[model samples]
Structures are given as structure tokens and as C-alpha cells.
Target: MDINQTTESYLLNAIQNKRLSHTYMFEGDTLETLRRYGMFFALNIFGDTPRNQSLLVEGNHPDFYYLHTDENSIKKEAVGELMHVMNNKPTESEYKVYIIEAFDKLTPQAENSLLKFLEEPPEKTIAILLTIDKSNILPTIHSRAQHVHIKGQSSDRLKELEYLSEADLQTLDVLSLNAQHIKDTGENFTKLRSAAAEFSSKWINGHSLVLLDIKPMLDLCAERRDYSLLLQLIDGYVRQALHSKLKLDIFEPFKEGVKVDNIIGVNHLTNMLDEIEQANKMIQFNVHPMLAFEGMVIISKG
Candidate 1:
């Protein structure tokens, strides 16, 4: 079966077999993509009838609750409101479904507020929490929900990524398959990725002062969020290098230059990826962007 058909079959079988979980964490590509799957699964669970479909499409479905926020972080108040609404019984259907998009964006208070509800949701109430990255999700929440990894775009979908070279596409495919995110980031995506690739290349080649050498690239970032993206891109390159070194099912070798497998040990690359994740978290927690970058480099070097 094709990608669409494959996903449809999975959902249909889940519904037919009456195997739906009380809580699900749909992890993958982008919020938009996961939302589509979440809504599809919700509709299927609700019988896919015309009236139910219209109600859901128009956001008037009494049995379905949708929660999303325009800001980066979702507050406890918002989640509490959802909990309050979900506490009631479904009016129209045997099951009530609630979908929370960008679940990774929930603040610590919000996640903590949700723990009890998720752990003991009202009977016949199904919760679908969607996230682009599951790493940011709290361990408590992660443990409570059944995780579903939505597969990324297929090869045919590569047609939409015409802006990136074949090698670039291969590199990014392992990192993220969200074409919209690349389009949203626009030129900065390409530049930051290039900067990251260059930085990784130098580090693997034993270049001293690799961190200082990338200062010009750092200066080009006009926004603090850029640091997060830059760190993510660096992590991606490091991962790609690790794959190359391990002789895994990599599409291409590290795009920058020499292979790092011989130069850097697998454990070191793994540790570097961990440090990069820490740097990204530092950036998320309002650390000075440059300091986070420098700290990652200094700590990795040590």
C-alpha cells in the first residue's frame, strides 16, 4: 500500500478491532501533519458519518474537544479548562475525543496539571496529544500515553523539497521531514544548516578554535530562535556523521568533507549530540544564545 493507504489501513483496523487506547501521543513530522492524523483517527472513532464529519469540520462537535495555542507555551489555565470540559459526559456519541496539538509546547505547570487527568481520564474519553518532538515531553506524560510515531513523507514527497540538493535532502531526511518548517525558516534554514555542516566538519577534522571560527555565522543570526534552529542543525550534522562512522544505512557520507567515523569515536559523537541537546535546552530556558553555543563547544572539548 501507498503511504496514505498504509496510514488509513492502520487507523481503520484500530477502529474496527476496537483497539483504541484511552490516551495516545502521536509523535512526528509537524503539528499540521500530526493534527491531520489525529483528526482522522478521531473521526474514524466517531463513526465517520456525514453529520459527525460536518460538526467536527465546523468545530461544533460536542463529542470532540480541540485545544491549541497561538503562543509558544501553553499555560496551565488552558489545560485546566480542557480538563473541566472533558470531565463531562459525551452528549452525542459513546466516546469523547480531545486533541491537543503542539503538546511539547506545554509549560511544566501545564504538563503537571495534565498528569492526573491523563493518568485517569474520564471513561470513554480518548485523548490524542500531538508533538513535533517527543524529547521535550515530560517523562510522566510520556509514560502515561501510548506513543505513535507517524511516518515521515515518502520518496515521492521529495518533489516538494526542490530547493535542497539531493545530498541536502538526504541529510535533512534523517533529521526532519517537515518541508513546511524548511519553507517557514526560508533562507535562514539553508544558511544555518550550511553553517552547522561547516562547524561539524571542522570539529571532526581536529580544527582548533572551531567555535571561534563560527562566530561570523553566529553574528548573522538576527533572532534568538535562530540559535535553537542552528543548534538543531548542528545536531543533525553530528548525527549524520555518526551514522557515516557506524557504517549504517546512510544515504550519503557526511556532506561537508572527510568522514568522521575514523576521526571521532561513536561514543564521542553520541556525547556531543547529548551536549547539543543540552545547549538547545539552555537556549529554550533563556540562556544567552552565544553562551549556550560556547558552552556546548567548551564542554564537548573538555
Candidate 2:
């Protein structure tokens, strides 16, 4: 499904059946998407009105908690705040939801503080860690909570155009097969951080080359939100994937260090490819397309 369709349908399903998970990791590459889902969950699940939604913006959600990580790392006090919030009972709703946006940025000390809470979470508290990457999360926290791997919305029109550029008449395809991989590696922004360090010289040397073709993907990378710095790297990598996997002739320095796995089926790849375009459009309207495309590229690399 496309980005608009996916969110619409998912929210519909959630509202229709109330199959809301207590803790969700709305893992995507865009900060906007992160906050968008945060709002969606708050408004729908807690029945907050437009006025209350404004309060959520001001970090005043009565039943909600926002967690942030500074450039240095997530502060130890953040965990303390969380513990305080969880210790108390729900104020307005059955679930006192916590939206831990960017929890993966937590410092080691910050992460450690929450081990006890994750193990035995408050009976009525639902903690959703909105993250681009969960690599930093402790195994203890990961194991205790139910893992909801919110994959990227399916590929959009840009992806469809990507596939159409190939010379061969349907000789091979990248979409439809990597659905699960897309979910697992949704918006592999974490990879870009390491890649930059690992390939700085190459990236710098190819700076001119990268700049020439980085604009389109960069445009789709969304605004310079919290995850802005890494968006360009991500955009470039997807360009590499589109050219490499789908056989498009995009010229850029290919990134290394990842073990490419090309075993996904056609169905998953097409769906993801289609969603990529929808996500791009959404990004044009201020939606975050980073993670959605990131997921597709990760899956395609496989």
C-alpha cells in the first residue's frame, strides 16, 4: 500500500478493532513521520480534540510523554522523568502512553535507567518508543515489550518510474520480495551514521559527484527536522540502491560495509517501490519519506 493508504488503513484497523499495541516503535527516518504517528496515536486512542492536540504539541499531553536525546546523548533525567510518569496511574485514559521519540539516542546511562521499567511496565501504561533505529535499545527492554515493526508505507510513483527505466522487459525486479526485510530494517538511518564515519574520505572525494545527483532524493528526504543531518546520506544511498538494484544508471559513489542480500520476492519489492513514490508526495506536503524509502532500499540491497 502507498503511504497515504497505509496510514489510513492502519489507523482504520486500529480504530475499528482497537488493536492498539501498548508500546509501538514507529520506526521511520523522518522526524515529521515520527511526530505525525505520535499525534495519530494520541488523538485516536485517547480521544483528544483539536485543542488537546495543540497541548500535545506544547509537550503537555496529559496522558502522553515525549522523550528526546540531546546531541551528547539522552539525558539520565529523561529516564527519571519516565519512571516518575509511569509510577503514577493513568490520569485521563486507561493507557498512560509514552512516546519515546528518538529513544535510541539515549546515552548508556539513560538506557540503563529504564531496564527495570521495561521488565515490569506499568499495568496500564503503554510506552511507544518512536525511533529511527533500535540498535541502542537494551536487549532487556526489547525482550519485555511487544515489538511492532512498523514497516515503511509501500513504494510510491518515483519507485514505479525507477522500475520502468530498466531496458529489459521485466527481466527482473526488486520490489514485492523484501517486505519483511523492509520491516526489519525500516529507515536504516543507523547505517548511514556508521557509513559516514567509515566512508568519509570517499564521500568527501566524491562530493562534487554526489552533489550533482543528490537533489531529487534530497528533496524527498523531507525538511531538516531532527533527523535532517542524516537525510542527505540516506537520500544518496537510496539513489545507489535504485541504480544498483533496479539497474538504473545513477552515478554516485556506492557505499560499502553492508552485506547485500538479494533474495526477496517480487511482490514485496513492488509494494515497497510503489509506496516510495507516495511517500515522496507526502514529503512534498511535509510528510517524512526518509524511513519509507530507507526501508525499501535496505530490502532492495538484499
Candidate 3:
């Protein structure tokens, strides 16, 4: 189940026939993928051309607005600001488009505010909400927007997997066995994956002092504002370590530098994963990146 030709055709036809929905929900495995599709949809609405498409991709279009959770949940105030913006006429195009990333992270109050706007969207204004988990979105909002599920083929995924280092691929293999997927292949993500592997090896070897080793990585994550990917990488390593201890052959490559016996027990790993999730939630709510990373480090130490 991937974003095949059929999905692409349907969306294009909808735009050409002037049947595009006023509000849409794009659900997918990765934010980057969702964003790609969202930009496609937006460019089509504005009459797709090389220049306009490039502007949309670079986020330079005046009529296009992109929003995401800021340090925390999408607050009510942000929604209010969006509503105000939407109420105005399009600045340079026939339609104004708003794309919100991590829509499920919107606070309850923000959802209420959004619901009102969705109930009666301004004419020629389009709203695109992107989320990895559709179930977390409010039912009322769900009813108002058309849902689009974006899936990627394993074969295509493997192609992107080529960009990863041997070690990163091994970590990804472990995650795949557990039904987890990482679709990013950017250089920054590759570097983060390597850092995660090194950090996991040291942490499992009972070298709490290795905190110094990860400080630079933490700073990089903060600089890039990529807390989500950082957490995902850490989560992958923990899961891989757990599989290694269980003598899972699929995780063998990842076991090279890991001390199998020194790895935390399954129970502790489970708890640590839970704590990491909580830390991610805190970040969604807008906690400082350094604070969130420090908190996760402290949890791992314990």
C-alpha cells in the first residue's frame, strides 16, 4: 500500500475538475513525505508551473501558509491567528492555502478553534492538516476534512535505504522487524542515525560517562530543531538492543559494539521507551530542546 499512480491521478483529476475539498487530512509514515504531497496539492491548486511549484516547495509563496506545533502543542492562539489570516482575501492567487503539520498535536482548545473555521471555511481558502496518526485527530474535525493516506512501497523504501550507512541500515532492519519504518534518507538523518548507534553502544556498555560523547549530537539536534527524529533514532536503538538481548538474529549486525549482557533488561528497556515517548510529548508541547534531551538522558541513566 503506497502512494501509487492511482492516488496521484485522483488528486490531479480533483484539482482539474474543480472538485478539490476545502479541507483535507494527509496521514502518512513521515512528515517529509506528507509535506511533499501537501506541496503537490497546493501547487496544483495554484496552477502548477515550474516557478510556482518551486516557490511552494521553498515556502516562498505568499498565498501558502505552513504551520506546525511550536515547542509544544498547537495552541489556541495560533489557531486564532490562522483564522484571522484565512479571513483575508488571497494576496496573490485565486486561493489561499494553509498546511498544518503534526495536526494531532493540536491542543483541545486549538481543535475547537479549528473546528469552527473548518465548519465554514472562507471561499477559495484550503486547509491541509498533516499527521502520522489519524486516530488522534478529533472526530468532528475528521468529519469535516477529506482523508488521504500516503503509503510507500517496500521496494521504493529500499531504494532510499541505500543512502544509509551499513550500520544505519542494520538499525533500520531491526526496526522493520518490529513494524517500524523510517523514510528519511537525508544526510542529516544519516548522521543522526550514526550518532544514535554510537550513543546506544556506550549507554548499554554501562558507561554513563559517555553523556559527554552525545552532547555535541544533542546540540546538533537543538540547532536543527529535529527533536522528533532524534527521539525516533533513540527509540530505534533501544528496540534494537532489546532484540539483540533476545538473540534475535535480525538484529545481529547492530550487536557489533553492543554489550549484550550489559544491555538493560527488557523490562527496563520498555520503561525507558515509555519515558522517551513522554519526553517527546513534552517536546510537542514546546519544551526547550536542550531540556527535553537532558531529561531523556537522565531517564536513560536511571
Candidate 4:
């Protein structure tokens, strides 16, 4: 039940005034947080009590439908199945509620199918689409839904970062970094993150000559064909460096080992992030992984 009070109040007011929209887009810093809010909102709509709240929380409610992908992405068939269920009358509550997690991961076909459903949602039914990256959602679908932003209080950032080590914060998928992910992935992720931090530190410090030292790591990325993860790691490092220069009290180990202020200005860091993004796009267009990485590193030198 713990969520952004402002968001909760706004939704409550909408419900009280009978102004709740048929389709809602819930955006937050992380998927888990948005999922919690989605569940809270659904329970309220169903007039759920403490005794029955467990059913909804556990996703066992007849009227409540939860959609997510266990595979790489949500396909068209999944959307069709969901539509079939949604077309049916609510079994218990007055409203049938569907919460779709990772909404941005839906394939193009699935997205088109979902758009049709959103355009003409079933009566007495609500659809909640959750995502960390709003930009990934199609503009056509975005235009049709009410947007809700769930934000934690500003003072909570330090507390949230407290549980994370510098490496965890640096290497984390910035969009999905949370305590649970850290706990579940554990030390292996941290080690990979540390490797990224080391790579970034050496590159930023004019130690491009040390490429030979990290060639094994680069080879590993090329062999695994996960250039995206490497790019994200480097992006995280740059973000941490920017935050450090801004005097934010976030955990950034590079602040201690390297004089970030001396090596790169905020402008340069910003451009480095842009370069990394372009390199990621290149990989998507079939550029060789090592070539993309080298190109990005060279661009960062500017």
C-alpha cells in the first residue's frame, strides 16, 4: 500500500468523481514499483478488503487479469488471447481489470493488436499498461491513455541508494535498478559491473594504451554477442560520473579513484552518452560488435 501519496490521492479523486479512464499508462522509475501501484489501484476499483486483497495480490482474482511476457517479448497471439478474455463479462467485480507489465516489450504485431483493444476497450473494464521507458510506447497508443507518474519523494533517493554498493549503482540498468534486482542477481552481476567501471575509468583517464589489458573483457563481450549490456554498463558509468561532478551524494567509486572533474566536463560526459547510444544503434544495424565498441571509445575521446 506504500506508494506516492500524490499519485494515490489523484487516482482516489478520479475514482470518487467517476472520472477514471478506461486505459491508463503507469510510469515509474522501476517495473516493480509500477506493478505495486497497478495492484493497489485494481484492488480499490474492486472494493477489495484486507481479507480478499490477498487474492488480487497473488493474481488469483477472476476479474483481474495480469499480462506479461515470460519469453523474449509479447507476441500477437498473447494479445489476441487477452482480448478474448477481456471480451467476456466480469466474473465477480463490476470492473474487469488487466495489468500489463513491460508494456514496451510488446512486438509490433502485439502492439497493433493492443492498440485496437485500447481504442475500443470492453465496457466496465480497465487496462493498466506499465513501463519504465515511456518513449518505447507508440505515440498512437500513448495518445489514447491517461498518464500517471508514480514518483517517490526526492528525499528517498539517498535511502534507496544506501542499500546499493558503488559497483551495483554504476553497472545497474538505470531504468530497472532496485533493491530486489540487486539481491537476486548478487555478486556475479557486481563483478561484471566492476569490470565495466574499470574499463570506463581507464578509458576516461587517457589510458587508451591499456586496451591490451582489457582485450579479454572486450573479447568476452564480442563472444557473448551482448554489446548492448556493455553499452548500458558504460552508460551507467558515465551517468555516475555526471552525478558525481554535480556533487550528488550517490555512490560512485570512480569519484575516489579518478579525478572525474579533471578528465571530463559535464558536456563531454553528455556527449559520451550520446556516442554510446549511436554505437548501440549501429550494432542494431548489423555493425560488428568490436567495431562498434572501438568507434564509441574513439568518439568518447573527443
lDDT of 4 by residue, 234-285 (tens): 7777777778787885645343333464756788878878988998899778
What do the candidate models score in CA lDDT, each in turn? 0.78, 0.52, 0.73, 0.72
Better of 1 and 3 by TM-score: 1
Off by over 4 Å in 1: 1-6, 152-187, 199-302
Q: Is candidate 1 or candidate 2 better by TM-score?
A: 1
lDDT of 1 by residue, 135-228 (tens): 6688888887888888655453355667877666765666664654565566566676777788877775567878785687787576666677
- Supply the TM-score for candidate 1: 0.65
TM-score preference between candidates 2 and 4, better one: 4
Kindly give the number of clashing pairs for every candidate: 0, 25, 7, 0
- Candidate 2 lDDT tens digits, 114-184: 77676677777777777666655787777666554454333421232232223211111222122222223
Please state every model's RMSD to the true fold in angstroms: 5.7, 14.0, 9.3, 5.5
Against the true structure, whose lDDT is highest? Answer: 1
* Candidate 3 accuracy as lDDT: 0.73
Cα lDDT tens digits for candidate 3, 272-292: 778779878888888976677
Q: State the weakest 10-residue window (summed lDDT) of model 4.
A: 152-161
**Worst window of 10 by summed lDDT in candidate 2:** 168-177
Which portions of model 2 show Cα errors greater than 4 Å? Answer: 1-3, 146-302
